[model samples]
Structures are given as structure tokens and as C-alpha cells.
Target chain A: EAGVTQSPTHLIKTRGQQATLRCSPISGHTSVYWYQQALGLGLQFLLWYDEGEERNRGNFPPRFSGRQFPNYSSELNVNALELEDSALYLCASSLAFGTNLPDTQYFGPGTRLTVL
Target chain B: SQKIEQNSEALNIQEGKTATLTCNYTNYSPAYLQWYRQDPGRGPVFLLLIRENEKEKRKERLKVTFDTTLKQSLFHITASQPADSATYLCALVRPGGKLTFGQGTILTVHP
Candidate 1:
């Protein structure tokens, strides 16, 4: 009955350094998604992993990447971070059954990454 | 390409009144549309879902309307309370199983 959980409620790092954010999906969920929410930018899609494969990604650059574990947890790694990279990183999970899943996505509390 | 949009301005409604929010999209025919509630410093929580074929859906005090022709969705909170204040987001899954979220609209219900 636990919802999605993320580590490092807050993160602070300098520009040019790498940042790693972790996410654990709800129990029994198989699809994990990553999103970045910043001022004015809204919640932008970053990546989607299903069944341990990189299924789809958003308009973000290649430096933004992630992997889903066999247990359905995931990690997002941002390389060459810039000042603009600072934002709340959210992780979501959904059932892999397909369209009938109601397309309902449950989100995590998120990791607030502040790049200085 | 595909895009989703929501009212960017904050909506202020008096407690016990009804609040209406809008979600619109372009360049895609989604099978289903969703509504989520998010609070400050936290991620979004699933609120409701309505399929394209369906006209309306209601959960507790929330009601969602979908219009495929208009490519728009409406979210309504009836008998609102001060605790209802939060940002509401709309999202849709593409044919490829990727979800696209709207910018979200902030709702502030005052007592």
C-alpha cells in the first residue's frame, strides 16, 4: 500500500558536477517515469522505463538518462549539470498492463536538486 | 508536435464554493486523460481519470469532463475546503505509452 518513494529529499551541488536521483515505485508497479518541474517550465517529461528497458524519453538532452531496476525502482543521472538544471525531480510509477491501466500515474515526493 | 496546456495563473476561490480548472491539448488523440493534485514542495497525486469515449467522471467531490472534439478536459471541485488548495495537473498518455503533463494551475481556497 506504500506509494512511490524517492531518496535525498534535497540535493545541492555545483555546476558541472553530476547528480543522481533515486526512485522506488509502488509495490507491484512495473513502469517508472522521471519528470523535471521548474519555475515556469512546469512538469516536463524526462524519461520512461518499462520492464527494465528504456521505452521512451522526452525533449531533454542525452545527458539526462536513467535506468529501471528489475524490482521496478529507477535512477536518474544528470551529467554536466548547469545552473538551469536545478529543479524538483519527480518519479512516477504505473502498471505495465497497458492502456486499460487507466493511464493512472502515481508520483513520488521528488528530490529537489539545486545546482549552484 | 504533441503538447498540453493548463491555466498558469493561480485560482483563488472562497471556501465552500466550487472551483473549476481547465486542461487543453493539441496534436494528439489520447485514449485517456488524468487529473492530479500537487502541493507545495511535493509531487503530484492522482486525482481522477476519464477516458476519451466517456463524457464525464466523478470521484468524491471531484468531477472531470472530457471533450475529444475540443481536445479539452475540465476539472471541478465541489464544496471546496481550504485544504483543497493546491496545484492541479492534467496528463495524457500518447499511443506509445509516454505521459505528457500540463503546466498545472494553482488553486488557493480561502476560509
Candidate 2:
């Protein structure tokens, strides 16, 4: 089966610009998650979307937001990008929770975002 | 605030040896701990998951041990090969399905 898929393998944006990253979950998966991995850092949770609802978010600022579509795809929008915003943004998908689905999350090849 | 930590330094070991990595957390009671393998430019791939009530889990040559009382987990690879070289990440699953990760530990198995 195809794993999670993300678009725009690489993106470059300048300060104050807006960047949009997209992710398509694996077939039959309903939960999508976004994470940011800054250089030399770990994966920081960004947002969680399940069943077209925003379930939880990390400590990131409001400028970082995203939404899930009816087809279970997700989009992460980073506004007012700063140099610190440069990182590899990862997307993961799993079967919706509480449906007796195992908790293993399959990740997609991340998008490398370079903010200048 | 909750924090997760993994050894930032890269681990070097000869092939056929066992490689062990550590993950520790503070101020968090996770339902389960997960391990993932990541290449230099790729997203992490799921490796293993151990629940809080479980003490150990193993898959093929990979083994994971969880100590809830000590708030720590250990991942082990036996008879390691050079192909196993990569960054190994440990993640803590929060109550509501969020995963908090630690900076990964890079493992280098030299032939």
C-alpha cells in the first residue's frame, strides 16, 4: 500500500511570506498529523486533524495553522515566516482513533522549507 | 511542561555488535512510547511501540524496554549491520493522540 504522500518536496520563501504545505494520507486513513523538525532538533508536533476537525495543536504560534479537507488530506500554512521557520515539515497518517486501530503512524517524505 | 530527551551524540559501533540508545522524559505520563528510524533527509519510519504497562517489546533484532517508574526507555539492536545506520527517534504519546518526540540519536555501524 502507498504510504502518506506530501507535495512540493522543497519550498523556499522569504520573511513575512506565507507558505503552504500539503499532505495526502494513506488510503482508508482518517487522521492526519503535522510536525516540524528544525535542523539538529526533534520532531515538534504542529497540529492534529481527524474526521475534518482540529483535535490538538502544539506550542507553536498562531501564525502556524492548518486544515483537513473532506477527503482526509491536510494543508499546513505558515504565515510571516522567519528564518527560524526553516525546517523539514513532516506529515503522518493513521487510522482514526477509537476504531480499534493500532496507534502506529506512517510518515511521508517531508517537505524541506527554507525561509530566508 | 513536558520534555523528552535522547542522546544527541552519534553512536559508533562495529558491525555484529549490539547498539543501545536511550530516551528519557520528564513531567509526562505517556500511554505508550514509540521508536522511529530516519534517514538524513527523510521522515521517520515507525519502528516499535511499547505501552506504559509493558516492560519490554521486541521485533526481530530490535528490542525496546520501558520503565514507567523511571520514566525512561531503551532501544536495542542486536548484531547490527552498517545498513542500520540512521537517526533513531523516541516519541511519547500523550493522552489525546499527540506525539512529543526527542531529538534523535544517530547510530553509525561501521563495517
Candidate 3:
């Protein structure tokens, strides 16, 4: 089966601009998660979407937001991007939450966002 | 505040040896702990998951041990190979499904 896929392997945006990153989850998966990995840093949770609803979010600012579509794909939008926003944006998908089994997330290769 | 810590930033070992990595958390009671492998410029791949009720789990040459009382997890690879070189991340998942990750430990198995 095809794993989660993300678009635009690399993206470059100037400061104060808006950037949009897209992700398509694996087939039959309904939960999509977004994370940011800064240079030399750990992965930081960004957003969680399940069944077209925003279930949770991390400590990121409001400028960082995203939405999940009916088909279970997701888009992450960064408004007025800053140099600090330059990082690798990763997307992951898993089976619907609250199941009897563990919800193990499968990740896409990720988009490298470079904010100048 | 919830915090997760890996044992080190990097580990180097000769091939065919056993490599052990550690993950510890503070101020959090996770229902499950997971390990993932991430290579440079790629997303993390799921490795193993151990629940609080389970003390240990193994898959092939990989083994994971979870200690709830100490709030720690240990990941081990026996007879390691150069292919095992990568950053290993540990994540904690709460009962509600919120996951918090730690800074990964980069393992280098030299041939």
C-alpha cells in the first residue's frame, strides 16, 4: 500500500509571506497530523485533524494553522512566515482514533520549508 | 511542563554489537511509548510501541522495555548493522492520543 505522501519536496518563501503545504494520507486513513522539525531540534506537534475536525493542536502560534478536507488530505498554512518558520514540515496519518488497537502513525517524507 | 529526554545526542558502536538507547519523561503519565527511526531528510518510521501494562515487546532483532514506575523506555538492537544507523526517536502517547516526542539519539554503527 502507498504510504502518506506530501507535495513540493522543498519550498522557499520570503519573510512575511504565506506558505501552504499539502499532504495526502494513506488509503483508508482518517487522522492526519502535522509536525515541525527545526534544524538540530526535535519534532514539535503542530495540529491534529480527524474526520474533518480539529481535535488538538500544539503550542504553536495562531499564525500556524491547517485544515483537513473531506477526503482526509490536509493543508498547513503559515501566515506571515518568519525565519523561525524555516523547518521540515512532516505529515502523518493513522487509522481512526479510539479504536481497540493502537493508532500508529505512518509519515510522509515531509516538505522542507525555507523562510528567508 | 511535560518533557521527554533521550539518553544522548549520538552513539557510536561497531557493527555486530548491541546498541541500547534510552528515553525518559518527566511530569507525564503516558499510556503508551513508541520508538521511530528517522534518516536524514526523511520522516520518521514507526519501530515499536509498548504499553504501560506491558513490560516488554520485541520484534526480530529489536527489543523495547517499558518501566512505568520510572517513566522510562529502553530500545535495544542486537547484532547491529550499519543499516541501523539513524536517529531513533521516542514518543509518549497519552490515553487521549496526544503524542509528545523527544530529541532523537543518532546511532552510528561502523562496519
TM-score of each: 0.95, 0.96, 0.98
- Candidate 1 deviant stretches above 4 angstroms: A97-102
**DockQ of each candidate's interface versus the true one?**
0.64, 0.62, 0.64
Better of 2 and 3 by TM-score: 3
Candidate 1 residue-wise lDDT, B1-111, digit = tens: 778888656899999999999998998788789899999889998988888799999999999999999999999999999999998989887577767788889999999
Cα lDDT of all candidates, in order?
Answer: 0.89, 0.92, 0.94
Best by lDDT: 3
Candidate 2 chain A, poorest ten consecutive residues by summed lDDT: A95-104
Q: How many clashes in candidate 2?
A: 0
What are the runs in model 3 whose C-alpha is more than 4 Å off?
A99-102
lDDT of 3 by residue, B2-101 (tens): 7999999999999999999999999867888999999999999999999889999999999999998898899999999999999999999886667899
Residue A87 C-alpha lDDT in model 1: 94
Q: What is the TM-score of chain A alone in each candidate?
A: 0.94, 0.96, 0.96
Q: Write one digit per residue (lDDT tens) for candidate 2, span A8-40.
A: 999999999999999999999999999999998
